[model samples]
Target: MFRFFRWFRDFRRNRNHTLSSSPQPSDKARSPCNQPIVEATPSWKFDSKARWSKEYDLSICHAEDDIIYVENLVSYLELQPHSLRCFLQIRDSVPGGAMSTELCQAVRESHCWILIISPSFLKDPWCWYQMQQALSESPTANGRVIPVRKQLERKDYPQELRFMYGIDVRLDKDNGFLKIKQAILYYLEELCAKDREEQQQRDSENLVDEATPQA
Candidate 1:
C-alpha cells in the first residue's frame, strides 16, 4: 500500500514535469486533455493453473490528442501489485502493419476495451473506427466495453454507448479513475472465477470417466 502511494507521487511529479517541458502540438487532434487504485494481490493471482488467451487486460481506444493522459493512466495501472497489461495502439501495434488489421486484432486480443471519449476522439476517424471494432466484438454491453467520458458534453455522447453507463472524468477525475480500475478488476476476477469453475467441472468429468469400465 505504501509503495503504491509512493509510485503515484513519483508518477504525478514526472507527469507535471513532462507537461511543463514539452511543446504543445499544433494539431488539434494532438492537443492536451484532462482525465486509482486497488492494493491487494487479488485472490485470482493464486490460481496458478488458470490460463487466458487474451494478451491484454485492457485495450485503450483514444484519440492522438489524449495520448498524454492515457499514457499516465496506463502507467498507473501497470504499476506494482496491479501489474495490468494494457494495449495501446501507439505502444503495442506492430510497426508497418495495416491499421485496420491491427485495430481489429487489438480488440479481439484484449479482455476489455476502454474508449476515451473526448472531443478529439469524437472527431478522429481512426478513434471511431476503433470503437466500431470494439463494438463488433460484443455487439452489446456485456461489461467488455468501458466508455470513459473526458471533456465531452452529455449531449455529445455517442448513441452506441448509451446502453452502458460510462465513467465521467470531466468533473471528478480521481473518482472516475478509481471506478475504471474497480470495473476492470471486477471483470478480471469474474473471469478467474469462471475459469476455475470450468476447470473443476472438467476435473470431475475426467474422474467419472476414469471410474467407468472401459468400453
Candidate 2:
C-alpha cells in the first residue's frame, strides 16, 4: 500500500514538472504591434530647385498692365517657405513677342494657377488661353484656380468664373492677399498628404517583395 502511494505521488510530480518545463505559446508573437517591424526610408536631401526645376508651386497669369500687382503678389508669396519658386512670365523673361511653348508648359507644370482679373486682362487672348488650359488640367475648381478680382464685379466676369469664389482685391487689398496666401497653403497641404500615402504604399510593396521566397 505504501509503495503504491509513493509511486502515485512521483507520477504526479513528474507530470507537473514536464508540463511546466515545456514551452508555452507567447502572447507577444500574436500581437500585431510587435510583429513585422519595418524600417523607414531615409529622406532625400537635395535642393528643391534641383529636384523639381520645371515645376512650380504657383503660377501667376496676367496681362502686361497688371505686372505691378503681380510683382507685389510674388514678393508677398516669396516670404513663404515653398512659394520661393513661383512661375511668372515677367520674372521668367519669357519672350515678349508671343506666348511660346515653354510658357504653356510652365503653366501646366504649376500646382496652382492664380489669375489677376481686370479690364486689360479680359482683353488679352493669351490670358484667356492660360485660364482655359489651367481649368482643363485641374477640373476640380476648388483645388487649383485662384482668381483675384482687381476692378471687376462678379456679374461682369465670365459665366464659368462667375460661380467660382474669388478674392476681391479692389475693395480690401490686405484681406484679399491674406486669402490668397491661405489658399496656397491649403493646396500644398493636400499635395503633401497625397505624396505620403503613395510613399507608404511603395514601402509596403517593397517589404512584401523582400519577404517572398525564391523558387
Candidate 3:
C-alpha cells in the first residue's frame, strides 16, 4: 500500500515537471486570429485642383455624451453589414463629447450631418455652427442634411435645416425600437449606395487622367 501511494505521488510530480518544461505560447501566438493593433494614422485625401473637389470621402458630425440615443446611433452604425467609413469628432472618445479642431474640420469636410437635437443640444454653439456650415456647403434647395432628432421640435431645428429631410429618430427612444432601427437602416443603405456611385465616379476620372495627354 505504501509503495502504491509513493508511485502515484511520483507520477503526479513527473506530469507537472513535463508540463512546466513545455514553453508557454505568447499572447499574440496563443490565438490563431490574434492581430497586432494597427495605429490609425490620418491618410488625408482630397482634391486640391478638381473643378469640384470635396474635402472628405464621406464625413459625419455627431454629438455624443450621456445621451443613450447618441451612443445607440453609433452602435447601430458600428454593427452595419456594409461598413460606414466615418469619423465622429468629439472632445473625448471614452467619456464622450468635446468640441475641438477635429470637430470643426469634420463638420466642414462632412457630406453627411447627423444632429442629435436634445434640449441640451440647443444651448451648444458647436452644434449650431456645424448646422450653419452644412447649409452653406449645400449646393441647392434640395440638399442632403440628415437630422436624427433625439428630442426636439421643428422650432428647435436650425431655421435653415428645417426644410431639409429629417429621420425623426425620437421614436427610437419610444415604444418600439425596431421600427426606428429599420428606418435608419433604410436611410443608411441609400447613403451607402450614393457613396459607391461617388467612388465609381472618382475611379473613372482617374482612368481618364491616365489615358489623357500628359505634360
Candidate 4:
C-alpha cells in the first residue's frame, strides 16, 4: 500500500508538470482582431494599354459665341508646367446626333467642369443641358463646377449656381485667368493627396496581414 501511494503521487506530479510546461499560444495567434487576410488582386496587368489613356483633368462648357474665349483659356492652361487636359465640345467633334451622349460622358469622366457664364451661355439649350449633366455627375460640388463669369452679375446667375462663388473674368482678365489656373492646380493637389493617403492605408493593412501568423 505504501508503494502504490508513492506511485500515484508521482503520476499526479508528472501530469501536473507536463500541463504547466505546455506551450501557450502567442498573443498574435490568440488575437481577437486576427482575421483571414485577403491580398488585393490587381485590376490590370503590368503592361496594360489602358494605363496610357489618362482621364481628362477638366471639361469646359460654353455657348458657341464663347468659343474664342474658351480657346484662349485652353491655350493658357496648356502653357503651364502642370498643364491640365481639357475637353472642349468644339475640340471633340462627335456626330450631330451623338452630341448629347458624348457631352454627358465627357462630364462624367472629367475631374472638373468649367462653365463660361454669359448671356449667351444662359440662352443656349446645349449649355443648359451640359450644366445639368455636370451638376448631376458632381452632386457634392467639391470645387467641381467652376463658373467663369463674363459680363454677368450675381443676380443674373442661375439659381443653382448662385450659392457658389465664381471667377469674374470681365472684372480683370489676367487676374481672373490666373485665379482659374490656381484653382485647377489646387483641386489636382487635393486629388493627389487623397490618393496617396489611401495607398498608404492599403499598404499598411497589407503589411499587417503579411506579418500575422496563421493558426
Best by lDDT: 1
Which lDDT tens digits does candidate 1 get at residues 1-215?
A: 64564466446645654554444333212212222233655645524333256767889999999998898777656554455667778766665667898789788888889999999999999999999989998897778899999988999999999989899986663636667777887778777778888888999999999999998
Q: Write the per-residue lDDT of candidate 2 for residues 124-194, one digit (tens) a residue.
A: 99889888888888777776799888888777787667767888986663636656766876666566656
| Candidate 3, 1-215: lDDT as tens digits | 64564466446544644553354444213211232222122212212232123333234444445245554444333332322233444312212224454466565654455566666677777677776676677645433456566557767776665665665654533322233334434444455556667878999999999999988
Instruction: Give the residue spans of candidate 2 off by over 4 A.
Output: 1-54, 95-98, 171-175
Scanning candidate 4 in windows of ten residues, the lowest lDDT window is: 43-52
Superposition error at 124 for model 2 (Å): 1.5
Clashing pairs in 1: none
The superposed Cα distance between candidate 3 and the true structure at residue 136, in angstroms, equals 1.9
Top TM-score model: 1
**Clashes per model (N, Cα, C within 3 A):** 0, 0, 1, 0
Per-residue lDDT for 32 in model 1?
A: 21
Q: Supply the global lDDT for candidate 2.
A: 0.66
Off by over 4 Å in 4: 1-54, 95-97
Rank order by lDDT, top first? 1, 4, 2, 3
lDDT of 1 at 160: 91
By TM-score, is 2 or 4 better? 4
lDDT on C-alpha atoms for all candidate structures: 0.75, 0.66, 0.48, 0.69
